[model samples]
Target: MSKRKPQPPPKTFSVRPKRSLRHTLPFGLLLILILAAFSFTSYESYASLYDADYVGVEVCADCHTIMYDRWKDSPHANMTHQPSPETVVGDFNDSSWMLPPEGQLLPYDDELPAMRTFTEGADFYMALRRPGTADFTSFKIAYVIGYQYRQTYLTLEEGGSLAPPPPAMVYRTARVLPLLEPPREQHPHSRRFVGANDHPQFGVEPVLCPVPHHQLRHSGP
Candidate 1:
């Protein structure tokens, strides 16, 4: 009986199989996370290229009111303003001065001496001349006014119906003008002359600080 019971127990055997997850949830979630990370990285790389508009100071004011208000009162912001009896600072009615005509020497010769003079006009006007053409045949001062160096000169395009100066004459004299002496550095109160590089400290350099800030230097070969 013992031998038969042992043989019967030995014949009955049970086997348990390994359990495995058949769902693709974990793998799918990992793939989604990887795709999301790649998309975020790509977006950051191309952000600058998408911003192409020239958002001036006015646009910045919309978001940063306080900062814009401070900048508005700054000297840099008030560079451009209407020339009124109060806002106008230069001597508009001062004596007229002679400016060398095109292709003429600075010192002025007896024959072809100073052929042009800058005089005060009845109203503000900008003097515009085409490049290479000394004959300022066509002139119009309607809507443009700008500042060159420290002097205030109106644009010829803003005169509307107001008559323009002669081909050689760029402006009119509100009154008789006197000749100005050549600017000297020691004076410290010299009137500005266009294209004059006399004073290394003053002129356009100190006035226009931002221009030289990022001026590109050319490398010689």
Candidate 2:
């Protein structure tokens, strides 16, 4: 009979919980990638700033062929060089002349002091007298500056090698030479005399490119 209808078997059901790892795993991976990229960039910047050296014009030419070509023709590139036949434009034909002391022309009425500039083979020399005395000191031409318009000669500064310039530079010297011209020699029309600037400090002087004074034009002969 309809005895208590057998209690319907209780329905069985299970509820599944949502996973947190799915969302968190992707977020953690993204954070890790960003950190790795930042660390790599920082290392590169540090290495470049502190570990670079002056590699000279040849190294520059490798990457900047066009720029190097233009600079090669400019006066700055030829401003200074080791003594050589082609680099030297001045006459070094074993000639010597007496220069008026300080600021005067030749043929002085009094026994004014005079300095001598002479050449031995290819080397140039300047003989200077100490002030208030007849002591003379001669300096040899160690380097030359200016070849196109005007030129100045430099002698190796005493104790120059003891203190080298910063590693970034290719060359450095504490000495400077004023423009000197022998009286008998026909100097370049464009050349002018400059005061001797002897720096007491040992270092490299700042160098700047000279502005071209005149341009050259070529024509058929």
Best by lDDT: 2
lDDT of 1 at 135: 36
TM-scores for all candidates?
0.28, 0.42
- lDDT of predicted model 2: 0.48
lDDT of 1 by residue, 71-181 (tens): 767655554334454444343342233333543443333233122322345444323232234433232222112232232232322322222132211122222122222
lDDT of 2 by residue, 1-221 (tens): 65776778889999887768987899899999999999887765644653464345666788899987887787656666766778766544443333334444334412433445557776766565543455656767666666655565556555441111111011123112223234524222233222123321111233432222322222232
**Runs of candidate 2 exceeding 4 Å displacement:** 1-53, 99-113, 119-123, 129-135, 161-221
The superposed Cα distance between candidate 2 and the true structure at residue 60, in angstroms, equals 3.1
Score candidate 1 by lDDT. 0.36
Q: Which runs of model 1 end up more than 4 angstroms from their true locations?
A: 1-56, 59-66, 80-97, 100-221
- Give the lowest summed-lDDT range of ten residues in model 1: 209-218
